[model samples]
Target: MKECTGVGEMSEMGRLVLLGAPLGNPADASARFREVLATADVVAAEDTRRLTRLARDLDVTVPGRIVSYFEGNEERRTPELVEVLAAGYTIALVTDGGMPSVSDPGYRLVRAAIDAGFPVTAAPGPSAVTTALALSGLPCDRFCFEGFLPRTPAGRRSRLRALATEERTLVLFEAPHRIAGALADLAAAFGPDRPAALCRELTKTYEEVVRRPLGELAEWAAAGEPRGEITLVVAGAPPVPAARPDDDTLRAAVAEREAAGLSRRDAITEVATAYGLRRREVYTIVHT
Candidate 1:
């Protein structure tokens, strides 16, 4: 591609550009990231200060009007940003870290821009999700993203229980303070021997990627405070036995899962699928 600077220069009326920034190390920033931030007419940033700091580090002079659009004010600010975008102005939406709308707030504006007949796209760059998954040494052919989990212990456990039998590799973002609790929940929900990796401060000086089972990870985090941003990659559940699971076997499996705090309904569904049986049969077996 040529050296394209501005979005308005294209054939579209207005464009909503999701500009990606580095997760930790600023050098991972792409040239296109700088160009979009430097030339776009309206720049919507999760944090204005952080954007400026990034530009300074990259030696890229920002020539656009910067506006704050984070989780707190995204709902209120969507209309205003859509208006600017509708007027043939290019607006770059960036987050404090990572891309917009992954775990950050930009979906509303992106939707509004699209509804208004404006073009939308992303200036792709570093993402903690893909980066961590690449280094996680786990299956990546099929995977899923489980953003930040609930804060309350009960709520978190409930969500983990729901995902207990998920077969695809899972990617999650978590805060430092809740690392131990989350790992413990994973251990309890997915079993202590479940394979997992904890990636911390990605691409930064204190960066650490610890690969182990959920139990060992929980123990490690309990030993010391694991600080900074965290991305967790968890291996999927192991394959079940080839032998057809009988009613007694299915009931035991469901009961064990239910005892692990999963709802009866979820337990039945999981057991039914695991043994390739109709949900009605599993439901009858569990309820009666």
Candidate 2:
């Protein structure tokens, strides 16, 4: 473990520290985080109000200058922060919650620092992403963080459709109100039987994690919207069949569809739906 030092102590050496704060619970903050907050010469925070509240909870006083560094100003602030870093300031970066740069402001500054040969490191803490992953009961060994889905239904659905066949477990963040719609879209794109978990208010008094099939979860979310922060974890699609269907099987499926008095396109669609085969595969078999 590295010892935390004040900015004055490190003024001679230029460095940028990406500090991870507690997602919701202050108790999850590490000792090093307190020290960094206490000593950093410049504290770049996503939200000053939230940062102050966190400082009060931890009983640590920030001796450095605090500045806003959020989505709207990140691009504009990056160059200025970089200048401070170059001037040998031990700058500490923090987000409103959780780790900075995961889905928050800090990436640009960290990247700039690294490119400029300034020392860079992290002080890890609680993450909604990992917390949800643990509660999800889904495979976490291989997973991808999608951050938040698009706000609109069409955009969100399109994004989910693109990941319909993704094999690695998926993690996403959603607002309380949008959770139900997101779940519904996920079920439609990934199938109803896909296992998933909805984590809400993690590490707080009202923290809840509900694990169920995506279809069932969507129904539950529809009944009533949840409050507080949310993290959604969904199981990935199973390995696809390795062998293609033989010509005989395809002919039999097409014959059954034709006997039902359906058009060729409708018949192929029905067969594909019934057998869980791709529409193009069924069409190729029927046409050829």
Candidate 3:
């Protein structure tokens, strides 16, 4: 019999399981989570201390080897864990809260494991993104999860401007300290009257969700930063009612685009697409 030397050997290949830690309450942890915590051969945690506390809270003893796998060490640690997995040891990857790799570490390891032909799976659990969206009262039917906005004011504004025309509800994670600035920038870019909700300390004691217009939320944050993990859900841009613009309107729209630095050809194409008219019609209107 040939010795199994690669991942194709089912009996010899180990698996990578991503465990989603509770957003706040330990009671939210599923039975499978506790089982994995107790039985995995090794556990890579974003915060080893938090894993210890979570195990204590859930009354599960993690007998496996525990190691820290955060942003600081993820790049350095992924190859090491892959070796462990190659050795047929079940490795459980977890973060302090919520799912790993959602604006958190674990993406690199997951990709690495897959590329190495190792089996990767996730024990799905609580997620702040979905939690905030469900409670936000915004249109959940069509939504986009933007893990976190750019940190600097200018970066944030630039990002918000790009998303200004999005028709899907927007969900974003933000730190408590920067929440105020984020909200203010959000209002400026998305418009002061845009509906939004600020979800804080979700699924934890002192949980608060403030549903208000963008401008109002900015003012509310200005008073004082609300503490705790924050998630923001903002309503998408309102639909533009159908209308046919006159030749003058088309010409003016094209001119506005040109003034904004778009070449005449590109501006005409944009205006034509926006008004559902032919490019030739817009070009004629612009020149005539």
Candidate 4:
């Protein structure tokens, strides 16, 4: 909510528009994005230089003030932009590439404007997340985005462990250098045979999407690092085995643990560990 002054107010009817720039190629920018950039009273961009370059490439001179809007300065800039929106200025928000707020900075301003009751809208464009997901050959009807895995091995493993049971397809972003390590972690957590796709340099001249099992990809990535933006789409875990525990089975397990003087929690943990079953699944039977 940083304050910006001296910029004149907009008409009461002016609306705040979030424009999605192309991920790489300038020609990919939509006609609507060009029109809005040309006509808007203010252009807020993630990187001013890149925005100017894009405008130059589009051959469309932005007719208003161009301000830098990025992660470091978003907190300070959101309020100023909000004021512009409140004053009825047609402000066009764009990132260096792709839609703002997807993994970019437009979310703060957009959220602020929306909460303030200002009209906000978007001009759709290329999205790496969806593009990779679509090309992954996995179930896309239902999915979730887990942006950028944790950097530390321990943190990343814990994250993967938590998602090991996720039933919906999982989408993740990774740096080219870290792709191999990420795949290794995925293999360890989701099992080697889990299906996955490695999408690299999406939408560019050298764009490549390689689909394979997590373990194989990890082995391939070990030879050399791939280039460009990377998106990893991993298939979710298979449904858990649905076998019901018989009375004898549950009673036998309980008796063994009780004879060892183990607490109910400890017994359930051991039995679940031994049987490759979910702790909750084993606990349900023992408690029942």
- The candidate maximizing TM-score is 3
As for TM-score, the candidate ahead, 2 or 4, is 2
lDDT of 1 by residue, 144-234 (tens): 9999999898999999999998999999999989989999999999999999999998999999999999999999999997999999999
TM-scores for all predictions: 0.81, 0.81, 0.82, 0.79
For candidate 3, the per-residue lDDT at 78 reads 96
Q: How many Å off is the CA of 23 in candidate 2?
A: 1.1
Give lDDT tens digits, candidate 3, residues 1-288: 232232222247788889989999999999989988888888999999989999999999888899999999899999999999888778899998999899989999999999998888888999999999999999999999988999998998999999999999999999989999999999988899999999999989889999999999999999988999999999999987569888888888888999999999999999888877889988877887
lDDT value for model 4: 0.86
Error of 4 at 66 (Å): 1.0
Q: Name the regions of candidate 2 deviating beyond 4 angstroms.
A: 1-12, 244-288
Task: Indicate the worst ten consecutive residues by lDDT in candidate 2.
Answer: 1-10
Residue 91 of model 1 has an lDDT of 88
Each candidate: RMSD to true structure? 10.2, 9.8, 8.3, 9.1
lDDT of 2 by residue, 191-238 (tens): 999999999988889999999999999999999998898999999989
Name model 3 segments beyond 4 Å from true.
1-11, 245-288
Error of 4 at 247 (Å): 11
Best by lDDT: 3
| TM-score result, candidate 1 | 0.81
